[model samples]
Target chain A: MKAVEVKHLYFRYSREWILEDVSLELEDKEFLAIIGPNGGGKTTFLRILLGFLKPTKGEVKIYNKPPNKASYLIGYVPQYTTFSTDIPIVVEDIVLQGRLRKGKFFYTKEDKKIAYEKMEILGILHLKDKKIKNLSGGERQKVLIARALSVEPKILIMDEPTSAIDIKGQNEILNLIESLELTRIVVSHDVKILFRKVDKIAYINKRAIIHEAPQLNIPKDRHFCEVELIDFLKGEECGI
Target chain B: MWDLINTSIYAGILLSIAIGIIGSLIVVNKATSITGSIAHGSFGGIGIGLYLGVSVIVSTLFFTILLAIVLGVVSLYFQDRKDSLIGVIWALGMSVGIIFLNLTSGYQADALSYLFGNILLVGDSDLKFMAITDLVLIFSIVFLYNRFLAMSYDIEFLRLRGINVSLLYFYFLILTSITIVMSVRAIGIILILALFTIPPLIAEKFTKKFYQTIILSSIIAFIFIASGILISYYYDLSPTPIIVLIASFGLFLSMLKRS
Candidate 1:
């Protein structure tokens, strides 16, 4: 079964179109990296997939169901930098938030067990008691990833997961993401993802171009500029 | 004198509970500006109540809840313009209150009481009402604690989790609106934001967990309120300003220590 299917999607905010007639598909357990420039509607497209915004025009489906209906199957990791640093919450609290289902007020023992298991999996069990603000950017991102994983989702979606981390941290996060067996969709501006084992790349700029990853032939030892990357994506046979 | 002192202390304790829970939320959510707008905007309802010769609480409750809903919508849909809109509502509310008071033919002495509360003047019925309000607020927070915390931490994540983020947001705003009304008699509109913000602001310095912040904030708020009441009683001065002044001093000290 396909993990995600977005067909002729269109989105806009007020006057200008943010996404235009974009479409893409992902098979189960596939890793897809979405790359785009600033104001390129990368984040806007993710919001639609999460069912936060209705597409102006088109259909978005996850596992053969609508985004809203398939919400339970998807775990979302939002940008760590987007939240306020002074929220006075520890890492444990944030991870527990993933277990938040409708009608459940308090965290059950089972929820705590699952949260702890995810924390351990991310090697952040010791840091669970640490405050979110006190953690390094890399650690904060890991905590967010753990939070997303605590849902035990079949699909994991991350937005700019490594944008705020150092290069070493970025590599570590990328490795961690690669290790996860779930179907993954990562939206990022970081060129470092090109070095990873992503199955496909979607370049979004008011529209989308989906390219198979192996065909790009990104050299491992050399640095890749964002502008050059966009040119490379455009040079490919990927369709818009 | 003894009765006045006792009643004021009781009011202070209740005030601490309300501000401790709601204030932590306000500070964490960065809704201080919106809350400030709502606090000031509630004055419009107070003025309308005065003009209509009806219960100020009822009129203020109706008006502020409506204002909260509007502000909530504006915050969601009009993110870029929310700051300016909040300012407009704040000024507009104060202006409408002043206009209504001016049009009213009475002495308007009670207007000062609403703007700057008299803790000593709190009667027995008012105490009962405050207790009831505190119970409701506590109940709501207890039942929806995780959702509220998630809302403050990352509203988008909560929405993706299938929670009705708007309804949760509106419910939060309504709680804030009611909290402001409950404090009007003890802290008043002009000085309420201080009590609503300062304790949590200070408590955040000492705690890393959300619930700890609330508990410590309640403790800190109680100390400020109790000391302010005591000092005001002895010095023959207004209690609310004294409370604000003491809380401000605490904030200053906390900042200094951090620096």
Candidate 2:
């Protein structure tokens, strides 16, 4: 079954078209990385896919259903900076929030077990009792990822999962995400790490162009520098 | 003296429940000024009630709920200018109340009580009303605890999970209005924000969980209210200011400890 299918999708904000004639499809458990320049509607496209926003034209289906109806099957890891650490919430409490369903007032024992199990998978069980404010940036990111995974979603979407962390932390997070076997959609700027990990790449600039990773001849061991990335994108722009 | 003490205790416990539950939400959501507007704006309803020969509490409840919905809608749409808009409503309600009271024929002998609270004058009927409000507040919290926690922490995430964020927010404002209006007779509208803010601020320092914060703040508020009543009794002063002063002192000490 196809995990995501976007057909002739068009989106606009105010007057300008943010996404134009965008069409794409992904099979189940396929890893897709979306890369683009800043304000190129990358985030907006993701928001539409998550049902946070609707496309101006055409249709988007997740597993043959509308995005909002399939929302429970989709796990989302938002940008870590979006959260405020001022609130007094513990790590376990945050992870348990993923288990929330409509009209369920209290967390059951099974929910607690799943929260702990997800934390254990992320190697954050030791930090379960600690408050969110006390964690480092990398640790907090992991906590967020664990929170997302606690829902046991069919598709995992992350928006710039490694934006603010150090390079080492970024590599660690990328490796962790690479290990997951779900249908993964990651929006990122770290092309070097992302290109190596993803099955396919979608270059978005007011539209989308999909390329299989093997066709690009990107070096396996060499680090992708900015100039090289720009040259590659420039080459692709020329229909090479 | 004993009768006064008994009344004070009952009112204190009841007010603490509202203060603790609603206060935590207000502080976490950063809705202090919105709640303040609701408290002051209900004065207009008090004036209307007096003029129309209706029950003041019922009228004030209606007015504040209306004001809460208005503020909720305004803030949801015009995020940047909400504070200024709330200030306008605050002044408008107080002014309208004064004008309506002026238009009434006889002197408003008990008008000052709503402005500053006269807990000493609380009757059996007031206590009964307070008890009912407390029960409603407690029941709402228990039934909606998880959703409230999610909403307070991250509303967008809750929305993504298919929860009705806007409807829940409206219900939240309604509950807040009811809590604020109920406390006006005991804590006074002018001094009620302190009761809603201070204990939570102090409790947050000692607790790392949401429920713990609510429970601890309620306990702290009860202690402050009890001690304030004792001090007022000894000095023959009003209990409202005394209670607020003790809470502010606790806030100060908490800040000092942090520093």
The alpha-carbon RMSD over the true interface for every model, in angstroms, is: 0.9, 1.2
lDDT of 2: 0.86
Candidate 2's C-alpha runs over 4 A off are A234-240
- Per-residue alpha-carbon lDDT of candidate 1 for residues B95-209, written as tens digits (9 for 90 to 100): 9998998888869999889998888888887788789888988998899989999999899888878789999989889989999998898889998898999999999988988
Q: What DockQ do you compute for every candidate structure? A: 0.81, 0.66
Task: Please give, as one word, the docking class of candidate 1.
Answer: high
Q: For model 1, which pairs clash?
A: none
lDDT of candidate 2 over A94-155, digit per residue (tens): 88888887767788999999999989988899999898888999989888898889888899
Instruction: After superposing candidate 1 on the true structure, give the runs of residues whose Cα lies further than 4 Å from its correct spot.
Output: A14-16, A221-230, A238-240
- Please tell me which predicted candidate would have the highest lDDT against the true structure: 1
Please provide, for model 2 over B1-259, each residue's C-alpha lDDT reduced to its tens digit, 9 standing for 90 to 100.
Answer: 8997898788888888888898988887888999899889889988988888899999999999999999999788789999899999998888888888998789897678999886776778888888888888899888888888878777777877778888888888899988888887887889988889898889888889988999988999999989988898889999999998888888988998761
What TM-scores result for chain A when each predicted structure is judged separately against the true chain A? 0.94, 0.94
> Tens digits of per-residue lDDT for model 1 on A93-132?
9999999998778999999999999999888999999988
Position B128, candidate 1: lDDT = 84
